[model samples]
Target chain A: MFARNRSGNSQVLSTMKAKQKRYEALIHAFHADIYRYAYWLVKDQSVAEDIVQETFLRAWRSLDALNDEQAAKSWLITILRRENARRFERKQLETVDIEDVQVHDDTQQADADVSDRELHRMLGGLSDEYREPLVLQLLFGFSGEEIATQLGLNKNTVMTRLFRARNQLRETLERQGENRGRANG
Target chain B: MDELEFRRRIYADPEATDKEVVAAAKADESKRKFWNEQLQFDKQLRKAAKVDVPDDLANRLIWQQSANEFARYQKRSRWYIALAASVAFTVGIGFTMWYHQPISIGGQALAHMQYAQIEESHSLLPVNLDMVNAKLASFGARFDEMIGDVEVVNFCHLSTVRSLHLIVDTPQGKMSVFIVPERNDIRVPSEFNDQQFHGESIKMQHANIMVVGSKEADLGEMKNIITQRIQFSA
Candidate 1:
């Protein structure tokens, strides 16, 4: 949505065309990434979808603000994060941890085995602070600095949190192993 | 870096970008094994976190935006039309064959294209296709869902034959579609398009649906959409 330009209707027309191109390109490029990120945040497919839609709509409204195309991924993530936050602000959802909520899909069952399931369950139990950075790192291959920028944490803090996050995950799996060993004995 | 630090770094990020950590891991067999195990664990966590995404989510979002904007534009344009029914706006260009009678399949499309700039304005349709479909339902022809964004969904008085008029957007250009529940008994040709355009009429749910588009358009895909997407109210 470009402002009518003084250059001519052609300028306006070209700008409109460019806007559409940017919008469609952004959707094509990041729809899935945004959708997945939103899904993890909200844990509901429909709500996540609505967030992604709203995020893109906002993106379209201010596409001119997006100067560097390289930043589009984080840019979209920012929009989606705001949208997801808005969702909670609007109304209180059940807000249960997704790990506790029974996923009706086969994705959970497709995990390698019970240990894999426990890992995912433990991941869901992690606080948003640790979970967000770890997911950002894995989902986007985002480095510690990128995660810091994304979450507004210092790079060192993000690395330390990620380090603690992995340690907790290891502790969880080891505890599960201990229980299994005891049951067998 | 020391082995303890190397293992700790691997625990933090199995695929760590730290060159020193990666170099040490590659250089030592124990560090290499530990990193491999951590990498496998990271991969599993990623897969566990993955969820199924909707198949047509992208198209749905695009359509949602386009339809919303089109609705806004239509709201503004409605006033301009309401102000006048002048000679130019009232040209009623297509539907010329009966110019008054209900047109046959091919003629309905042929008449619809008479406006010349038919493809242009026809693309900006009234956004409420359900209302348009209800109007079609009056003639006993309706669709469960639209396959793509349509520009025109209205009734046309081509020669006196009342028919449902539709112009759906195609990749190459706009394809004019006319559905006549009244003309199934009428003898209709299979299909044809000249240098200027391409068209085909296929019988659907006891209705004559003729679609015509520019030569560049894929009438095959157009036809497939018509058959697959449109289901009778029954």
Candidate 2:
């Protein structure tokens, strides 16, 4: 009986170690992308760091729930997004301009690459319906079906929003151009 | 697909490289043109979404995870066994939150000041004032005075005001300047110091310019010069 108990205890210890190993691997592999996604979600490094920390803590609890490595990025993203939403709920976050929150501060944009300025504004201006899918697609590289699953919406709705997001973005750019032209004229 | 359907599909996902979109694009001239234009737009969206990620994020996360695990293990095992561990974890987090509280204003610029060394960004892109002014103008904030050729300048948003963060190369070292729009909520201390930097918040008519420089930098002279130079172009 003692031998059996010893073996069982070691098994438990090994299982715990295995879980730790897996969690560490996940953290190392996906933490940056997770940070990037969180950065975009909250638009601040400190907040993004807080959310990423919480997301991983939660992920450590549910590591066994994730079986497919292929699904890991989306899984982490879903967790981060949910955590971000919960944070918003808890904080009752005010409407801080998200344009500043984009952690993806590419130097190229700072170059004032004029051709893309209007597009940048309209893209940032998109409502969550369009913006979420677009961000998922653009930043995280999630496909339509993956986004649908992550967001708990139908594939059709995700696609429509994705399409409409670009449409609205382009149409908004055109409207701005017209205004600019009128100002110039 | 017909023209309308093609437009809809391309409009929603301009960069869709799926087999169906590819085949459809190849089938017709107008569809091909639409696809190319959409791809070009995709390139721009890709660019605008560029961002900076904190370095050492993974290790920091692992350390955080280890701390929590240690805390949990203590709760499950001997209470005294993890006493030091749990207390350390709690204090560490509390201290960190005190360090990284998502403040109302100047929070992001503060982040740059603190972590630029860790992140190792040695140079800022060459941005003309007109371009910086245009971005600042988007939010109805402008600096009429010439603040000199700062390395980086962009209009950033705080919870309350549209702020501009500038990283200027100074004789002492680099300094981060946040021109934050004024609100009742923003109450940064007039003077503050950290281990590596000492700075002050200079209140302006329509905004507050909080500047942080290396410990050796003369923040007073910097503040006085900036105050004289900056006028909110009403």
Candidate 3:
């Protein structure tokens, strides 16, 4: 009986130790992904950094609650989304001027400026409600179910909004084409 | 075949899942063509939004984390000293009260002259044999009753705010010294030259008692016996 108890105790201790190591590795692996997601949602770099840091700090504190390694990404993202919401509860945020945000030219966007510039203008013209879900889905690559979970909406609602959001973009782009052609003619 | 479902699937990802492909397969040609165009647009949008993270950010975060850890370790060292003092005082109340001075304030070339004054003049010192033994052990030295001979003893304000009692054996009469680390703004008399303090200020140590002493009491010839014995690297 004594031998069995000793072995059981050692097994529990080792499992706890291994869990801690895995948690730390996951934190290092996904820190940037969490930061980028927060940045896209908030659109303010500093706030995004704070949100990501707080998310990871909360993850560290609550590591014991996590049971499966595969669930780490979603778990961290859930924390990030919560932190993002809590940001608005404490203080009224200043309305960001999306139009004034200057995009830095990078190697990725080195192609012709005309279409890309129009796309950026169109994206900025969107209301935050429309732009947010689109960014989460298209940019962050979140599934509809994951987006629904993050945004506190049903999966059906997420799909409907995404559907409408794309239609609006297509219509806006088509309208801009018509206006440009009329001007040239 | 609805216009809305077609656009959502295209915007979601170009290579839709089997469920999506089967749904699109059943759709009319016009709707299918719209999805194909929307899929192309979505690809362009994804490529456009994708950002290259600055390389310096990762390096900076690592450096910041390491520096934060180093700072916490330094703070923990001070806390440990305070904790050890509390435990030793609790364990040896009888011995510490009997023999220890309220504070001990003299030594060889370098002295740690704190304000040795007792609130009740009759109250015992906080140190005992074990406390002395601990210090001696840390320095790899055996505890001696006296500080191996001293020079000066005096009481001076540790800062403009607090008083310190000190003793030193300067060639000038074992000089009593009282050095204050707190009064940063006070002008000292011409007798004491103002030098940047490189010594540990006990006020900052989180100990119940504050230590006030000289900045460079240990240097040059003083280096021999006083190197590791004294605390405070800078």
lDDT of 3 by residue, A1-185 (tens): 99999999999879867765765576667766667667666767677777876776676567777667547777887888888889889786774754565443222444333366556556666677777677777655788887788778898777777777777877887785676568668
* lDDT (10s digit) by residue, model 3, range B1-114: 466556566554444666755576566777667666767788776654554444554444444544655787799999999999998888799676654433222221122222
Task: Put down candidate 2 lDDT per residue, B181-202, tens digits, no spaces.
Answer: 6666566667766677776898
Instruction: Report how far off residue B198 is in candidate 2 (Å).
Output: 97
Name the top DockQ candidate: 1
Candidate 2 regions exceeding 4 Å error are: A1-17, A99-121, A177-185, B15-20, B78-234
TM-score of each: 0.55, 0.53, 0.51
Better by TM-score, candidate 2 or 1: 1
What is the C-alpha lDDT profile of model 1 across B32-79, one tens digit per residue? 888888888898888866656799999988888888778877987986
Ranking by DockQ: 1, 2, 3
Off by over 4 Å in 1: A1-15, A103-119, B2-4, B26-28, B74-234
- What DockQ results for candidate 2? 0.34
* lDDT, candidate 2, at B51: 54
Q: Which regions of candidate 3 fall more than 4 Å away from where they truly are? A: A1-28, A57-70, A93-96, A102-114, B8-15, B18-27, B88-234
TM-score of chain A of 1: 0.80
Worst 10 residues of 2 chain B by lDDT: B116-125
